[model samples]
Target: MKKLVLQFIYGVVVKAFLRIIVGVKFDNGKFLLNEKQFIIIANHNSHLDTMTIMASLPRQLIHKVRPVAAADHFGKTKFKEKLSNYFVNTLLIQRKRDKENPANDPIHKMVDALDKGFSLILFPEGTRGEPEVQQPLKPGVALVLLQRPEVKYVPAYMKGMGKAMPKEDSLIVPFNCQLVYGTPQIISHADVTPILEKMQHDFNALQEKLR
Candidate 1:
């Protein structure tokens, strides 16, 4: 019953909010494949990025996405934790800087989530940064891909989210934004550098497509 309610809120309420506030447009187009499971990586720009991406998806797909969020930021307060639980399927993980050589890597939690057959929404850039600013892809995403080599990888890019709600601001400014999904790719190489570079390139290309 709780899952059903949250799905309604996300697939309907949040979708409406995004349409009203940001004029969010999604161009899944040829990229929406038949694959049910994937590891989606996107460029992080603002708090709205994750919501925008999820809301942009078809309702069925939206419900299947489990966003990997930072625990320290989103789980700081009970209210925030409840809100996240009610709205999205979020897997909260600790920041790398918060613990050194911890017994359990947070990535393991992501692995568990994938093992259950849910698609992931990850920001390989790690944290929000200036829109269109180049940030190196973290190795954690690559490691996950290594572990789950059979999972499809999709690159999504958002444009205008930083301006809509800049990282420094709490108030949202009405702006038009686009979520572009690129073709799905399978990881064949053991080394992740080339794969990361290709994803970064695809993200940049998506950003350019919006301009």
Candidate 2:
């Protein structure tokens, strides 16, 4: 029943809003259909970033793809938590660590999701910064990759999402947005530094290509 609702939301509602209302154009979208579990990392700009990525995916995979979101923001209130969980099917993690409970870390939660065979949509920037500006990615993504060495990583860059729905605004404007997917690659490195560097490089290349 939950899967049916998610399919309806992503396949019909979100798809229509992104494709018709917002005019989203997807490049290399075929990569999103890969059968293997992987992580799709992208720049964070607006709330629409998650919805846009979700809508771009194939309807059958809606239940298999989970977006990693901040617990404080998306799961702060009971109503918001239910909406994000039941509607979006998000995997909410704490952005701030609890000093007493080491097990409550975000990286552990993310890796657990991957182990469960769900492809993740991650915003490495942690939070949405200024509109249209790329911020330095947090090392949490690199940490996750370190644990799941075999999982493929796909780079994605989104444009015009900020203008369509800026970080400060709740009302979405009808503007054309673009989402570009880069080739998926497995970064084999003993250290997180090299993994993070390669991830940033891939994201930069995708952003340049989008322009």
Candidate 3:
């Protein structure tokens, strides 16, 4: 039942809204349909970012893609939690960690999701920032990549989402948006610095492509 609902929502409703209503130009979107499992690292701007990415994915892969979202924000209320889980199938993680409980760590949870064969949509920037301005990516993404060195990581850049649905506003404005996907990379390096640098470089290059 859940799968059926997700298929309809993502395949019809979300896809129509993004493509017909909001107008998203997807670059290299075919690459996503061919992969079985992977990680999508994208810039954080508006709440629409996740939906845009989700809508771009092939309808068949809807059940396999899970966006990593903040537990505090998305799971704050019971209704919101149920709605997100039922519709978006988001993997909510605690932004604030408890040192005593290793099991509660966000990286561990993310790695676990990967181990289970679920592709993830990750916003490396911990939270939403100024429109079109990307903040420094947190180390958590590197940590997740380190644990799963074999998984392919795709760098994605979203343009005009901030103006379409800025962090401050609850209402969405109609605007043309662009989503660009870079070549996927498998980083097997042991050091996190080089991994992070590569991600940042790839993201910067993708952003430049849209400009």
Candidate 4:
């Protein structure tokens, strides 16, 4: 009952607030996927970026498409933690911390989620701010792709989100949101590095298109 109520609040009220107040709309949702092991590598510009991403996915997929949020940021406050766990279904991870393998607990948790048929929505830049222009990606995304060679890569570019909720602003600027899905690329075990580079290039291209 609690879960259902939370879902209603997030899926309906939150969606309406974003759409009605912020002028956000989701298109090309049919391009989004389920069933396959996939990674959604998106550009990070605003805090509200996740909503636009979630808006495009079907409800069932929304529950399963976990976002990889930074531990320090999301873990700083209890409110953020609870909200991420409940509304975003985020999979918070510590960055390059230990000698532990990538397949450690958090990675294993994600593997288990995917094993149960969930996908990931990750920002390869790791932090929210990239260059004013597009920037190079963090290796965490590459590591995940390398380790889980079967996962398909989908590059999604978002525009106007930085203006909507810029890093420096406390207030949000209402603007129409844009999200576009590019062709899916498959990276096998042997082609990890090149695949990652291609992923980076693809993301940059998509960002350029948004600009």
Candidate 5:
């Protein structure tokens, strides 16, 4: 209840600042569903990728979406800290040379959320990418699916964002950008790799089409 009010207020502020300053735009947004706990996955291409995804979601569902971000990136800055806590609901995961198994830690919080039928937004690429090309996907999302096949899998592709607002650059490019949310899919344990692979291909194809 308290979270809902904060989401409403923060949603307006976040959306306003983004649309006005970053010039972000959302497209094909009706496909996002509010039913099941979702394992929303997408390609990683730009720094604004996180904000773009959040901005594209429906206001009511916005409070439920949490982005699994690299601890090394979003955790480094004071400004990003607040944004992550508020907007991203940032689940900081270790993406490093010698990382510990997340399953042994507070990751139960993620499992618990799914248990409670909460939705989440995450990147399969793990981190940012090279230019317009998406970064290679990690097996983490699928592993999450294997643990909870009951979860819905949504494939979203954000185009023009890499150019609209890039990493290490404060200047925003005033181009009409968009986010494409495809139909949600379920990844059963049987032959799951192909589904994830195809989804990655489909996501990249959609981004290219949007571009």
Candidate 6:
């Protein structure tokens, strides 16, 4: 169906296109296909970030990689919903929910996906911001780690994407960009406070590496 076609385009064609335009490079990219569960965390800046990150991975792992996207943004329209689900294979979650019940928490859905053995691509910054700028880490990622502390946390940093596809523009510019995959870290703490701090620190370290 359409999903298969999009996946094919993403895995084959689009991946090549991104490499050519952005000059995508990988460090520690071997982790992309390794036999271990990962919660891939990166800074969100451009719409291209998701695709570029996914494209860097091996083609066969495309279906196994699920980007945690904001439901309100990607689920607003039927076409977007379909495209998000099929093309990128995203796990869309509502950002706003009842706070009284942990049963209704959206983080549970992410935890469930992790338990199902699917690798996740999470932007802990919550919303797209200026590329290379340090946005505060959202607690959602820390919440997931608190639940599944054993999952490998991979930090990725991207640069020049804001120029390629800025938040104020819909049209993409052909600008050179780079994405660097950093060493994976683990969270063994039950408290999410320290975990959030570590998430911020790891992301910062990756950004420093990019500079």
Best by lDDT: 3
Residues 1-211 of candidate 1 have per-residue lDDT tens digits of 6557656776688778877766787675334448868988999989998887777666666666789998888889988987786677787888663235443467777777888877888999899999667588888788888888888888888888888889899888888777888888888678889878777788888878878
A best-first ranking of the candidates according to their lDDT comes to: 3, 2, 6, 1, 4, 5
Candidate 4: C-alpha RMSD to true structure equals 2.8
TM-score for each candidate, following the candidate numbering: 0.89, 0.94, 0.95, 0.84, 0.81, 0.90
Tens digit of per-residue lDDT, candidate 4, span 19-78: 788887655665565445577888888888877777677655566677777767886788
Q: Residue 31's C-alpha lDDT in candidate 1? A: 47
- Model 3 C-alpha lDDT per residue in residues 151-177, reported as the tens digit of each score: 889999999999889999988888889
Residue 84 of candidate 3: its Cα lDDT? 90
Candidate 1 residue-wise lDDT at 191: 86
- Model 1 TM-score, 2 decimals: 0.89
Q: Which candidate tops TM-score?
A: 3
Candidates' C-alpha lDDT: 0.79, 0.86, 0.87, 0.71, 0.69, 0.80
Q: Could you tell me the TM-score of candidate 5?
A: 0.81
Report the Cα lDDT for candidate 5: 0.69
Worst 10 residues of 4 by lDDT: 96-105
The C-alpha stretches of model 5 lying farther than 4 A from their native spots are: 1-6, 28-30, 76-83, 96-109, 188-192
* Of 1 and 4, the candidate ranking higher by TM-score: 1
| lDDT comparing candidate 3 with the true structure | 0.87
**Residue-level lDDT for 205 in candidate 1:** 86
Stretches of candidate 1 above 4 Å error?
A: 29-33, 97-103
Q: Give candidate 4's whole-model lDDT.
A: 0.71
The positional error of residue 201 in candidate 3, measured at the CA in angstroms, is 0.6
TM-score order of candidates, top first? 3, 2, 6, 1, 4, 5
Backbone clashes in candidate 5 total 0
lDDT of 2 at 169: 93
